[model samples]
Target: MNFKELHNQKTPLLLGNVWDVPSAKTAEKLGFQAIGTSSSAIAALLGYQDGEQMGFSELIYFVKQIVTNTNLPLSVDLESGYSRDPIIIAEHIKELVALGVVGINIEDSIVKDERILLNGEKFASTLIDVINVLSKENIDVFINVRTDTFLLKHSDVIEETKKRIKLYENAGANGIFTPCIENESDIREIVNCTSLPINVMCMPNLPDFNTLSSLGVQRISMGNFLFDTMYSQLERITKDIIDQRSFQSIF
Candidate 1:
């Protein structure tokens, strides 16, 4: 089945979020149904902050490497498409498509000194322009429109998220991704509000896979948690090796 079709399954499609070739390869070896890049994780790997600090070309190179080294269907976290211009975003999408990517998560928020949500209506319009450009070229991509309402903890978040869901769906989005949505009630309400597959990121309080499927979450993402967890373990192992004056951690 195709990448998009994976979301239509009765249970949620768990995306193994990877940062590099090793991570992607690991996901594949573990029998993950699919994999996607973690923009924050990738940026951190390159000694940069998240939110498009890494250049689009750099992202392309890294994605190309992962695609070349793996057989699984891959999606990318475009992180606002690396440009405000919708046409440029479409061009970026085209480049990823050429590299064998099947889906993308493009968010509606941008980072200044801190994160902030873009005007939902305006962002939806941008999605329209971006999708239009891709359509003209006959390119098909799973445009998983990522909205930051829950992540930013906006007041009236659920209502605002449902509103953005409609706007994004109307703008030709194939799915809706709202990071930091951990509540079962919110997930069910959001899923009830739209036909688009709802994607939730890994949060401290996020429900288990069975609960998520029961709530009608069509997709689940690890975001950057796996990358963080792996490195955190490595740091601990190094400390243990230093204290013992032996490379015991290697075993």
Candidate 2:
């Protein structure tokens, strides 16, 4: 399905990011309309670190597996296209489309200091190049370009964020993502600046549900929250069982 069309629907698409085939199948079975692959989840599953630690072949393999397992639309987090070279990244996008992903989330962030680092102009330029390549294919693959301004600890959040949104939109991104914009006004400002759907992360400081829905957010993603939660809960439960103690407290 086209990402923009999906966004135009009355209810925003809620995507659950999965790490493997079983999880994807289970999510589809549970009636989720679409499923996304979390980069961090995939990295943890492969016993490698995130942020390009896994290569293109590995990513395509995983995407192919997920596609084989489920009928739902799959959106992959192809972190920075796993290469800085724009041409290579564009070619990789074509390959990912071949693997049957309906959408992709490419970020403007490089990994450093235990967090995402923004490379706004470079990332946007590569994305524009990738879009041109996809155009030649005559295919409509959703390119949800992610910006890390809100996610990072940086100044000039507004100007920097505006620069990214405008650049990527001009670059032909199907949608935009700002991972952790906690303040309502900040979120509102972003929504106002771009006509493309704004996808936000569901975190602890998430805006009130009613308020967010009123703000014109077209999509919401759980990102790596599900995997982290599962890991944390499993650890707690097993530790309690091993210690002959009952698991207590609701998550």
Candidate 3:
């Protein structure tokens, strides 16, 4: 099935999030249905801070490498589109589409030293403009709109998410990604409110796969958790090697 169809399956699509070629290869090797780039992880690997601090050209180059190396349907986490201008964002997305990207996760948040939620109504307007531009250019790609209400710890995440998802749905979003939302009831509330596929990210408190599936989630993402865990293990092992003062661990 295509990337968009994957979101509609009875079993929620489990997306392996990768930052580089090896990670992408490993996900494909292990049989992940699809994979997505974690923009923050990619930025860190390139020695840049998260958000859109990494240049668009740099992102295109890195994403092209993954696209070239992997066969699995690939989605890119395009944080805030790297620009507020809808035209420029659409153009950036076009670059990804040309690189064979099947879908993308674009969030409604910006980074000014830290991530902050954007005005929902305005972001929806931005989405409309983006959709219009893409349609005019005949560019088709799954646009998963990420709302940061839960991510930012909004006072009322469930209600705020419902409000934003409706706006996004009307704006032609293909999916809704609510990161950092873990409570089963909250997940059910959001899922029940939106016709668009509801995507939930991996969090420490997140429910198990079956529970998420039962709650009506359509997509489950790892965000940067896998990359974070792998590297955290690497750091620990390297530290252990130093403490032991031997290369025994290498074998």
Per-prediction RMSD in angstroms?
A: 0.7, 2.6, 0.9
Off by over 4 Å in 1: none
Clashes in each model (backbone N, CA, C under 3 Å)? 0, 0, 0
lDDT of 3 by residue, 1-251 (tens): 89999999999999999988999999999999999999989898888888898998988888999999999999999999999999999999999999999898899999997889999999999999999999998998999999999989999877888999999999999999999999998999899997889999999999999999999999999988887888898898898899999877767
Residue 134 in candidate 3 has what lDDT?
95
What are the per-residue Cα lDDT tens digits for candidate 1 across 1-251? 99999999989999999989999999999999999999999999899998888999989889999999999999999999899899899999999999999999999999989988989999999999999999999998999999999999999998999999999999999999999999888889999999999999999999999999999999999999989999999999999999999997889
Q: Residue by residue across 217-238, what tens digits does model 2's lDDT show?
A: 8888988988999999888778
Model 2: residue 24 alpha-carbon error in angstroms: 0.8
Tell me which of candidates 1 and 2 scores higher on TM-score. Answer: 1
By descending TM-score, how would the candidates be arranged?
1, 3, 2
Error of 2 at 64 (Å): 1.0
Q: Which ten residues in a row have the lowest lDDT in candidate 1?
A: 181-190
Task: State the TM-score for model 3.
Answer: 0.98
Question: How far off is residue 164 in model 2, in Å?
Answer: 1.0
lDDT scores for all predictions? 0.94, 0.84, 0.92
- Measured against the true structure, the TM-scores of the candidates, in listed sequence, are 0.99, 0.92, 0.98
Model 1, TM vs. native: 0.99
Tell me the RMSD of model 1 versus the true structure: 0.7
